[model samples]
Every structure is written in structure tokens, then in C-alpha cells.
Target: MNGPTRRGDLFDDVDGARRFTGPTTGDERRMLIDVLRAQRSTLRLKCSGLGPELSLRSAEPSALSLLGLVRHLADVERRWFRQVLAGQDAPPLFSSTTDPDGDFDGATDDPQVVAAAWEAWRTEVAFAEQFVTGAPGLDIEGEDSWRGTVSLRWVLIHMIEEYARHNGHADLLRERIDGAIGL
Candidate 1:
């Protein structure tokens, strides 16, 4: 892997991250899947090589943190893929009815908390990948309370949007934490 930026610089070398390996040419489904994976990889790269600082609420007044983003993305993966797409009953791993923000609110500088966040995120991500792979096609539809009938294609697109939006926030938070920037 390549090294980070030089001192006092905000722009890190893009090649250093190598988080975007998506093919420059592919069909719609393949392209979407690859872009989404690259977004996921970008999130991971933004949070890499951090210690307890991952839990630092650099955004202030909001419970946003690198660890929180990890946990929240895990919940998102579970909701859209397992519950909505696969018709499973998997509930939020880090949030609840009375604690909808538990994923972010509970983010702390504990080793176990950090470990659990990453584990849950990875598990949900793996399940989502499998579900998408085994899916007959993106046309497969599911009912969501918020969006009514939603297709796997729509879910994949929404997930890409979600990650892209959060990755932007992550960029700011990360820069605040360690002056690291660029993705």
C-alpha cells in the first residue's frame, strides 16, 4: 500500500487508499455492485488505523463518529438486505424502538464496543453480499413500510446513495480527528 500525505496536507494520495477498484466498464448490475462495494471500501479506508479516537465525537452536539458510522451501516445492511430483501426478521443489531440512536449514542472508546461494531458490520455486509449474489435478479421485490414495494435494484441504489452520503460526513469527521482528508 502507498503512504499517506506529507505533513500539514489535507489531500491524501488517492492511489494510497486503493479503495476504488471498480471496473471502468460493466453492465448495469455489475457496475452498481462494484460502485457500492467501492463506497463500502471507502468507508473502511476512512476509518482505518485508528484507535479509541474512532469514538471521538468530533462533529459535536451530534453523536456521529467513525465507530458510530460502522454500527449504523451495519444496521442499514441488516434492514435493507436481510429484512427487506430476504424477508428475514433480523432486527437492528445496535438500535431499538426506544433507542433508535443506540448505534451512535452507545459508541464509546471501549475495545469490546469497537470490536462488536466492526464484527456486526462485517457480518451484515457478508450476508448482504451473499443475498445479492444468490438473488435471481434485481427485479425481485419486497415490501417496505417506508417505501412500500421496493426492488433489489432500488435497494442497491439506495444503499450506494446512503454510503456515499455518509462517507462525505466521514471525511469531515476524520479530518477533524486527525487532519486526514481526501477519499
Candidate 2:
């Protein structure tokens, strides 16, 4: 991987943190999915080009750094998609039944931790995307036990919203780490 940038200059490389500039077709569902994927890519970009120490650094007492956000999102995908969407009773990806924040807590500078996080998140994403593709259609009126009878459309919208919210958190955390912004 590329070496990290200097302090207060984390986003020095424009080519590295490029946002989603792909063509637009004006479909709401597709657009929303694309936006979420772009945000996901942006999160990855923020972590990239950084040294392990800097990537794992915790500027505040709370574990709300970019690394933590990555881990959290990975777990969220597994929980919402693999468990909820697929109607599986399995436990969360990283979080235990008793410890809800296990994913964030387990985040570390260890390569194994990072690799596992990526794999879990990517796999969940793939599963979620596949589910979306195979979906007969969005039924915003449908409800479920977990989501309180939400429609498929609602779930997709909620996922996008969740990602956007976390991406905002990621933006701040990334900025704090190296002063990169508005990628």
C-alpha cells in the first residue's frame, strides 16, 4: 500500500480519494444503491494510503475513528442483510449476543482484524445486492418483525440513509486523522 500522508494532509492525493463520478441514469433505486456504494468506496479510500498506526489511531476516547466506522458498517451489513433480510437467526458478524459494540471494540491495527472486517463487509454487501437484484419488487408497505413491517423499498432507503449517516461520521473521522476532506 502507499505510505500515509503527512499530518493535516491526509487527503493530499486526489486520485486516491475520488468520489463516485460515474454516469447517471436517473433511476431512484439504482441511484440510491450507487450512492451508497460510492460512499462505501470513499470510506475505503480514506483508509487507504495511510499507515497502520495512523489508520488505527483514536483521537478521542470513543472509538469513532475511520477504522471503527469500517468495522461497524461491516457488522451492520451482516446483521441487517444476512440476518434480517435473509431471515436468519444467526448472531451478528462481529458483535456477540451480549455485546452489541463488539465490532467497533474489536477493531485494531492488526492486519487480520482489517482483513476480516473487509471480508465480512464485502460479503454482506454482495449478499444484500444479490437480494436486491432478485427482489420481485419493492413493497414499501410490507412489514417484518425486525423492521416492524417495513417494505422492501423502505429497507433500501433505510440502508442508504444509514450509510449516508455513517459516511458523514467517516468524513469527520478521516479529516481528524489526516485533514482530508470533500473527496
Q: CA lDDT of each candidate?
A: 0.89, 0.69
Per-residue lDDT of 57-150 in model 2, one digit per residue for the tens?
4555676666667777777776666666667775677777698777777777887877777777788788878877777777534435566766
TM-score of each: 0.91, 0.79
| Pairs in clash, predicted candidate 1 | none
- How much lDDT does candidate 2 score? 0.69
Candidate 1 lDDT, tens digit per residue, 1-183? 998855544546464466567677867788888889989988887887897999999655999999999999999999999999899999999999999999999999999999999999999999999999999999999989999999999999999999999999888888888888775
Q: Give, for candidate 1, the lowest lDDT window spanning 10 residues.
A: 7-16
Off by over 4 Å in 1: 1-17
Best by TM-score: 1
